[model samples]
Target: MSNGWNHTAKIESLSFECGFCNNKVASDIGFFNNNNIDGLRARIRICPHCSKPTFFLGSKKLPDISPGNDVKSVPEEVHALYQEARNCISISAYTASVLISRKLLMNIAVSQGAKENLRFIEYVDFLAENGFVPPNGRGWVDHIRKKGNEATHEISLMDRDDATELVTFSEMLLKFIFEFPASVPALPSA
Candidate 1:
């Protein structure tokens, strides 16, 4: 014997029956289809008294959401840093460019699994190890870090040529940081 409620089928719609007037009321309730493996399940409410369905309430389908592959892709934030560094270079603000490049490198380093509060020397080491910067470029990084420090700390005069050189170095470093991922292998067990 098959009961009326035995079959689990997707409810297409529902209506209401008024107990007092003994009249069938077509409810405006909505129904949503939950498409699952067993069958489609509907979200709806029924009037208890008259044992009649009422109100076609809105329905929703289960979304097939998943994490995107871009998470594993190169970080786009690095590109923004590159642009800022490039802009600083274009304006002949070499000191500013160098500072921005350092920031960009730090960002890249962290994204590549560097720990927080990494020292400047450690950053230079990582860059050199990853071939992101030349070993001799340590001086450049040091100079920029010092210039940045001076710009922030001391009231020293900054020359245009210095700024221009800083910008050039920043551009070189930025290029290296952005392109190094393609050449390097994935991070190993540390």
Candidate 2:
């Protein structure tokens, strides 16, 4: 008998990408929680590569990290780095995300005509001094710089809130510098 739903009577092995290891493989289902009234099934699947458990609520993964905001008309290289930072958050790599957010500041500055090989702080300053950083955005840009420096120099790990804030700020900065400017139609040369 075939039911309209995609649920199977019994699931032995499931194929999924391990969030921790980012590997696609089939692994044995460790256990399942079934709710008869709601027909909801929660499964814990073990990742063979990382030996970690991923929680799935009826095939929907838990801890579904937000993918961050999307800005159009971004340069290809900058877009790639921005996506990398965003993807790091999805894998719970908060520290990596924070670091990438910091690097993005440098990239943005250079893309906006700032000189290369400048000190990290200089990049932040260039953005602010040249009117690249949005008004009232210098604070959060500094936050990204400080947190990123701590992640690099100290023995501390970045939390979700820190990563989210930096990534969000980076998105806004990119929009301000790239997307928003590209959005306007260029005036015809006289």
Candidate 3:
């Protein structure tokens, strides 16, 4: 078969995970000649559905967060989830961001000793009851909760504004739980 590059070669559809829509897709990339003409390779580096370019990744590295930031003391799993949520937001995956933010909240609560096997609402209650989250945080948390619920149980997609708001709240929650406490200096014994 022939494609965009105008070459006769056997083209195969490759599956891709798109960052933009947070969906998996298959695309037929066009074949191209190797740098030294030693071999041929297919280069379908764009997602057909979203029209966003995709990477032929060999590996992924964790994004850098500044050393002095509160993210350092954050538990590994929670931090990972939070970063992924941000990644989704960056790529306009608002629905995924909302959902991931909700997951981040649950992870925070659990890390702070909230009980397991509780609903997301119960997790909110647990966080409040245990003071893992501040009184001021309740409203934002609830906002994220409801939005995430809509994204979860309903056929809805959050907008950029909503995702940004929720992600900002999630960042604040992380700092409140991890960064603020670590900034205090210990008092000398009398």
Candidate 4:
């Protein structure tokens, strides 16, 4: 899961469906040192998560985000961006999906009365601090933060699975922030 020495990539982990085997798994990446070139452009080596000898660039995007099912009953502004994110995921545009999901989270924060003019990372913290998202949810939301950063700032592509995870997390977050609360009634005074 790393480019060889003289390469600048740390890689770490990449989750995707193998184009060859059509199985979803986190594929480990490593540089293929042919001609001893140290650049990543020529070093895109794919590892089969399965023991089978198959090379895959990546698999088609799964329909992970659904506007009709996933975003139904969600608030309007948030739902619009969330649907966009989901649409991106369906088309294998993980980068765009992530960016839209990030925006969705921001919209959720604002809808829930979080202060305006804060950065995206701050919104995550605000959600946790304000009890909009429980403490345990912070870690996964932070994962979205990382993915959002990569999607916005890096040239390297992200996997559909990664964006899917972010969308799923966003769906949960939206439910916690909006749908669940709306369905629940306020308690009467004793």
lDDT of each: 0.53, 0.81, 0.71, 0.68
Q: Candidate 3: where are CA atoms >4 Å away?
A: 1-70
Model 3: which ten-residue window has the lowest total lDDT? 60-69
Of the candidates numbered 3 and 4, which has the greater TM-score value? 3
lDDT of 4 by residue, 6-68 (tens): 343335466655433446666455433334332222334344554432222233233322432
Model 3 sits at a Cα RMSD from the real structure of 10.6
Worst 10 residues of 2 by lDDT: 1-10
Q: Estimate each model's TM-score.
A: 0.44, 0.70, 0.63, 0.62
Considering only N, C-alpha and C atoms within 3 Å, which residue pairs clash in candidate 4?
A: none
Q: What is the C-alpha RMSD of each candidate to the true structure, in Å?
A: 21.6, 9.3, 10.6, 11.9
Off by over 4 Å in 2: 1-63, 188-190
Please give the range of 10 consecutive residues that has the lowest summed lDDT in model 1: 62-71
Clashing pairs in 3: none
Quick one: best lDDT, which candidate?
2
Give me the overall lDDT of model 4.
Answer: 0.68
Question: Candidate 1: misplaced stretches above 4 Å?
Answer: 1-74, 89-98, 180-190
lDDT for model 2, please.
0.81
Candidate that would win on TM-score: 2
